[model samples]
Target: MHLSFKNLFFTIASVFGIFAILILAKPVLIPLAFAFLVAFILFPVCQKFEAWGANKIFAAFLSMLSLFLIIAGGLFLFSTQIIDLSENLTEFKEKILEIFTDLTLFINQNFSFVPELERGELLEKIKSGLSNSVGTLVGQTFSGTAAFFTGLITSIVFTFLILIYRDGLVNALVQFFPENHQDKAHKMFKSVQQVGQQYLFGMFIIVLVLGFTNSIGLLIIGIDNPFLFGFLAAILAIIPYAGTLIGAAIPVLYAFMSYDSLWMPISIALFFWVVQFFESNLLTPKIVGGNLKVNAFTSILSIIVGASVWGVAGMILFLPFSAMLKVVCQEYIELKPLALLIGEKNYTDSEKDDKPGLLKKWGEKIKGWF
Candidate 1:
């Protein structure tokens, strides 16, 4: 009993210590974490260039430059789309006011016993609240913008350094373990690298497929700025359950505001539902693969924990981080249960294909009779 209590105390203390450190050192640590992910994505390209006879430094530089160009171009396009969207803010505001008017009328009609406030009074209260909070909002926006740029610069620098000294880092990590376990350490390192690369590449492909499909569907439905909403949805889909709902809501609300017909908004919702269906059922299983799949409950819990700890960056980073954790867990005998707890049920292709139902057997028999 004493030993068990001692172990429990130490475990709790260790967890709290780690949490405190993460919260306190977020500014530096978050960027370093992001840099590692960037390095994982760029590592293969760097290796390819090196294999083609370029020096490691030059190869890293070239890979980084390529990534920079892709990001800058995407940002340029997104900024232009946002500018176009902003130009119609007056129209959007008008629609919002109309929505509030309709909502107020509906509530007043449905609940005659409830006291009704004047629409102008409601608007006045909202305006006053906004005016009072303006200063706080402005301060936060400025601080956030500064922090974003700082993190971006730090991550870029760190990514380059990581790519340049990757070999040394690997050796250093391996040496941290005892001499006898060095081979296992190297294997774990390779596993981490491969998992990170595969997961990131798979996510990239899913995003493209989702974006294209979403845009095409919206365009066919005759919505304005289909590409813009589709792109936004694709990006937001990275956040899992909550993100898809929010992403779909944006387009549905826009469709309602932009179109007089109720069918347009309904159709928009249905389209997203169908896209999400394909995504979960077909795209994800086939592309992302079972290897990186986390249990649904664990994934949600991780996202909540990550968001509480580190905000939006944590939400984006935690999935790959969790997958890496699973990989690490699998490397140790004692941690195998942890890997299983967080992972999805794995089925081999033969097992999946070998399951033939009674209906299938009957159909085969009928076909043979015909």
Candidate 2:
């Protein structure tokens, strides 16, 4: 029962090697992961249909169809609005420039000993920078759009197949382990599914509420293109704090540019602040219900890391992935310490007792092996 150094080294290397592969394969895997996530989100609806006497295949098909239609309709509606907004960009830029000029003049008029550059030169530089930035942004947008459509098509096809043959996939995975471990494997799979489903459904509801509430508020504040801004905000809300901050900037900037009065932008900023306060304090808690036990700090850190590794897809996928990892660690005795480290204290009282501290357990194992 002696543990060899060679064996330990091999184990560590293997883990690292797998991680490397995952990083390298991220581009290919992103669509598949997205498909699985979408399927996971739709699982409850499929289950409800099944409960209502429909077969699994039929239920899945109906759910997918409904999702497709909703997405298509939203895209169609938004496309027209986006085109109109793009067409008015010249006017928007002019308004923004006027505001900038006014601010510059105010600063020069009010402040003493401030050396002022020629307004025309400054404006020209700003315009040149903005033009370059816009061109770069447009190029990136075209590339991103192409990538998104490609991923979307692949995800849709894969999701349909996955939903259709989900049972077979489970069975195949179960077959990978020994006969005695099949039950454990099944249990683990169930835990993953439960955590994923709960997270996805809860997040969906929360994001929808956020979008609608913000949209309504913006409309009330007389913001142009409220629906577009609100929708973007809601979608960005999926990324946690960063999403809200970025989402707020759009309307705030629009308010500042669209109106001559500073009061309007100030009011809009206040409105966004209130909406965000409500989301964090009220909506998130009521909807998500503390199932995701990661604290705010860890949640943000995980999102930043995930987004870095996987781009936007990473950010969206990271939350549920972390949740699933926590669930697995809680279920497996050897990995319990990891669960404790990743999860909030409120979510893991039983796990604390059931799973020993990681270092202690590892030390004992090493000693026993020797």
Candidate 3:
């Protein structure tokens, strides 16, 4: 058989062209992606309601309402804690500065041989840079907030429409292809939905567990604002490894500054380490399992790239998006290799045993054919 260079080039170009479109249309695509994510997450609830004799439109409305209520309740509960934190910002800043000064003095005393390590100048430079960065960030935030609200309104409308006519949309998409391919398209859509639903539900449980554990642990460790820290931890937990460490810093620093003894901060750190240990070994394996099984390295790399591309929203959405991408590729014969790279190793003994035997069988078959 002859290789079709023309077909190969067209395929490669089409793939790159789509990627280019995604990047170019990111302003629009980001909100659409977020709407899809919200719709995917609430799909199971809608399904259950539908099964319970509610119509699709009514079920979708109820689900969306439930989602809104949950969000609003959380915001109300956390509002006071956030306000308290903001009010104490000056105190936190002073405490941070004092700690920095002490650290600078200690470093100067211990590392006097390093003449270029002038703590005062370094501190001044850092302060100036931080101030400038903060000013720029605030300006960007104001502009971004306006855009975010606009997007939120649009996404809500889009989600409502999607839920109301999800079946119709699916039918239209399936019909776009040939009749023979329609079944395949429908199967692929179902697979994607199943994977997305499982991942979102599992992640929601994981986040709640982590949040509650963190809250209780911080309170036990004598952190003043346990709830706020817990909430922070929960939000951060969405991003995997990086979120946990970053979330831990709030309570640890609070403990360090508020308490006279270092033991408080030390205890807080130890508590988080223990909780994380349990989460990784017990909770995650049990709750999340091996489904949507992305590799740890890929998770981290995706997070970094996602954060760069779409900020916090990107980081939160990237995992499942990547998982869905993997599922799509896994369904295609030509892209299975890419899926394997992103996926976890098959550790089942049967699969492991079959690997070498399959290789030998293939070799023998090739020899016989020759």
Give each prediction's root-mean-square deviation over alpha carbons. Answer: 7.9, 9.1, 9.1
Better of 1 and 3 by lDDT: 1
TM-score-based ranking:
1, 3, 2
Runs of candidate 2 with Cα error greater than 4 angstroms are: 1-15, 47-59, 76-84, 97-117, 125-139, 346-370
Worst 10 residues of 2 by lDDT: 353-362
What does candidate 1's lDDT look like per residue over 137-229, in tens digits?
A: 999999999999999999999999999999999999999999999999999998888778777777777888898899999999998788888
Evaluation by TM-score, superior candidate among 1 and 2: 1
What global local distance difference test value does model 2 have? 0.78
Q: lDDT values of the candidates?
A: 0.84, 0.78, 0.78
Candidate 3 residue lDDT tens string, 1-370: 9999999999999978976786787777887887887898787678778888999889999999999999899889989988988898898887787678668768877888556666667667767877889989999999989988988887898788888888888899889889888999899887887667667777777788888888887887767778889878877877777788888887888877778999999998888898889987677656655556577877888788778777777787788888888888887899898887777654333343223222234334643332
What TM-score against the true fold does each predicted structure earn?
A: 0.88, 0.79, 0.81
In candidate 2, how many clashes are counted?
A: 0
Q: What value of lDDT does candidate 1 attain over all alpha carbons? A: 0.84
- Candidate 2 on 38-60: residue-level lDDT in tens? 98877767767777888878988
Per-model tally of clashing residue pairs: 0, 0, 0
TM-score-wise, the better of 2 and 3 is: 3
lDDT of 3: 0.78
Give the residue spans of candidate 3 off by over 4 A.
Answer: 1-15, 48-58, 101-137, 345-370
